[model samples]
Target: MKFKHYNQQQTVLLPYSFDDLIPEQHPVRVVDYVVESINIQPLLKAYSKEGNPGYHPKMLLKVMLYAYMTNVYSSRKIELALRENINFMWLTSMTIVDHNTINRFRSNKLKDSFKEIFKQVVLMLASEGLITLKQIYTDGTKIEAQAGRYTFVWGKSIKTNKAKMLTQLEDLWNYAQSIDNDDNPDPEPTQFKEINKEVIEQTVAKIDAKLSGNEKASSKSKAKLRYIKNNFVANLEKYEQQEAILAERNSYSKTDTEATFMRMKEDHMRNGQLKPAYNTQISTENQIIVHYTIHQNPTDTKTLKPHLENFEKTFGKETLQQLKEITADAGYGSEENYDYLQEKELTAYVKYNTFDKEQDKNYQKKNKPFSKENLYYNQEEDYYVCPMGQKMHKTHQSKRTTEAGHTQSLSHYQAKNCESCPLRGQCFKAKGNRSIERNHNLERHKQRTRELLLSETGIQKRKQRTADVEPVFAQLKHNNGFRRFSLKGLEKVELEFGLMALGHNLRKKIAA
Candidate 1:
């Protein structure tokens, strides 16, 4: 078959401008709207100088925020996009900016400046009646930090590892010397033999220098160096294994000692490697994150009160007063948390056990004749009534004040009461009598539990907590590929967490 083509010249023209592609009322427009609405002019006046040649703070802010909203985290990517992508061009008004400028704006200028801006957006939404602000959910999810688990070399572990290395090095050296003197020694020994000889020699020298018994350097300093070297060697091996596994798995895994392992709840056990991570807490109202922070703590229990206080600070006390309820999962539940919510006059729906039904059933079956709920309390007498209907006398009442000045009233019951009860075998497995201790704030806990069970609004609000917060974490870990952090130290990790929360909020805004 033969095909003939006629030579023809055709010119095609594209008419749409970058601005035309972006809607006038897009969330990116809200960036300008918020700046104008809050009158950032005063802040601009305070920082701007007539002779200075700096990018307008507002312009830089808009570009950075727009980039964050779209998940373009790297400043280099944002800089390249500004000259190439239409949407970014529209956001930056077609300005030719460099990566350094964008990076400095995000890392230095906006870190402090944008905090106030985030707060203002919360207030604006509250004022417009878009946010109820009557209730909030507090929760934390682990995000990988830039630091690695190996970065933290425990002093004890370091000493142990160094001793082990020295022992191995000595043995290898002795073995090499033995092999060299053997009758069957090859003119050229295997590479393993040569490598082991070199390693043993080098390691012995390093160990001797480190343990030179020098008086100039403190023992602590010497120990620290030894520990650091041990950690470096271990980390190098770890990285090699991690690289092999990642290559086999065909995925990117961070190698920095400071890099932490963070995965979404669903992907947590994906690779069977538990990594050091940071817990990021977000306080949300009406589906928007009002306050956020990053903690070095691995568990959710310790993060509750801090984030609540942060939320109050971000929205002000008056605004926080309107928040009547706080919701969280069982991970945040504890006697201390119960007291904290009670002291703040805030109702909470934090479940003590996420799988209570199954757990209760298993516990009941495991210990027959007496279940946990069978233990009865006699409120009037300030004592417990045994299953056999015996009245247990109060052994003692102790009072103590916490550092926060909250008074605790504790009462312990007599052991003799269980000794005489017919159901004593079922109630007390111990040889001595059973004792019951009750907190003064027990009533507050009872009230809160009742409210959580009975209030429709409370139940509905609590149901939304997991849906709202978990999805944010899922997107961060799975979609955006933020399984671990790229920075080190608590403060830097916190800054990255704030940026992530900001990214999530921006996505919510854009989707809305």
Candidate 2:
């Protein structure tokens, strides 16, 4: 028994063309077709005319998009595929692009222009009836950054160090004053809270001069002063710079400063491990990712408004004007988000934190009897009737501003007396009469949301949301192994995920 025909040095008379080598209905054909149909004028303008001949942006984009669609993320692996993989060779028309060129095109040339390409593809999908932009399911998942786990800079630690330094500086200043015995004050800095390099230098000079020839000052004190002048001052500057980089974020990675430390859901050991990650918020319609935004904030609540705003910015005002429904999980159902959704005139199917608990029979029977939801509100009298039938009148009203700067008006209500009430122990655990702060607007929104979510159309939308958007993440993170980003900074990460999203849509189109 032997093989049909085999020769080590055999050469065919005519080499097989790529078109003959590739299949007719391959996914590469879909990727190539989609890339060719989208507008690339923004990408073309990113190139300069002064360079030596370069690879066409369209060709490079086709190769990169197909590479990502097939789960080949590394530039070197893509380069190898261009050399060896028939589909890649066919996609690029047999043009061999090195890894460096591929990386430069992805990182530099595509940095400012990738969104345009992504938008064009999404619009094409929308036009083809593959996805509907009128309704969207939005959700967020934390994707780990390329930064190291331990390379973290926390804002709290910076503030603590700065506070300690300020205390030490104040002690040194008092020590200098004690030794000098001069009634006149040194003219430098009295407050160390807003210290700068110049203030530090001036204060250090005055302290050093005051302690120069003073016999009362101990050598240890002198050494401490010198340490503050040399090391502490430099550290203070470093801390200030870190604080500036950490604006509005609790912690950021030193390797990738824009990546915040967030507890990811992908932990294998089940222990909550905080790693540098970006909160990737995406809007999907018909299982296709229409828009995605990378955020440094970890929680999904604060990201909704910005995510929708970014969607509007990416697609255009007309798309937002025509948007009919918005659906998200409980994490995005904040007062601010609900208000924003109402202001935009879009029907919201978002669930609040206690929406499920409100639905539970046991929870409603056992735990929610005395909850704010169960209490009877008299809009005419501006009061609430507690479980004990006591009137809780509106005592005052105030405003609350969230970290995102959205202000909410809260009405404070208090029961007249609870000392002699029979249900005092069950009513509340507080010392004084029970009181509750209520946001009327939020309560109204929650009431409307409950009606919507419990309705027929809302139930179907909720079910579709779970099926439509979640599998995209499941395919991307688990099946495709895209849990961790390959780029360092936020902008590059956005560009990389744009490629991933675009690839996902193209692959879905092929499957369709």
Could you give candidate 2's per-residue lDDT for residues 1-512 as a string of tens digits? 97798787999899879898778898988888887788888888888899698988989988989889999999999999999999998878888989999999999999888888888888888888997789999999999999988898999898787778778887888888877867886654667665567767878888988999888889999999879877977797788889899988899999999999999888855789899999999999999998999999998999999999998888889999899999999999889999899999999999999998877888879845688768999999899999989899999999989888889999999998899998888878899899999999999999999999999999998899999999999999999999999888999999999999988988888888
Root-mean-square deviation of candidate 2: 2.1
Error of 1 at 87 (Å): 1.6
True-structure RMSD, every candidate: 11.5, 2.1
Indicate which candidate wins on lDDT. Answer: 2
Name the best candidate (by TM-score).
2
Span of ten consecutive residues with least summed lDDT in model 2: 187-196
Candidate 2 residue-wise lDDT at 309: 96
Candidate 1 local lDDT, 179-234, one digit each (tens) = 34346633222222322334544654544453456444456545545554466466
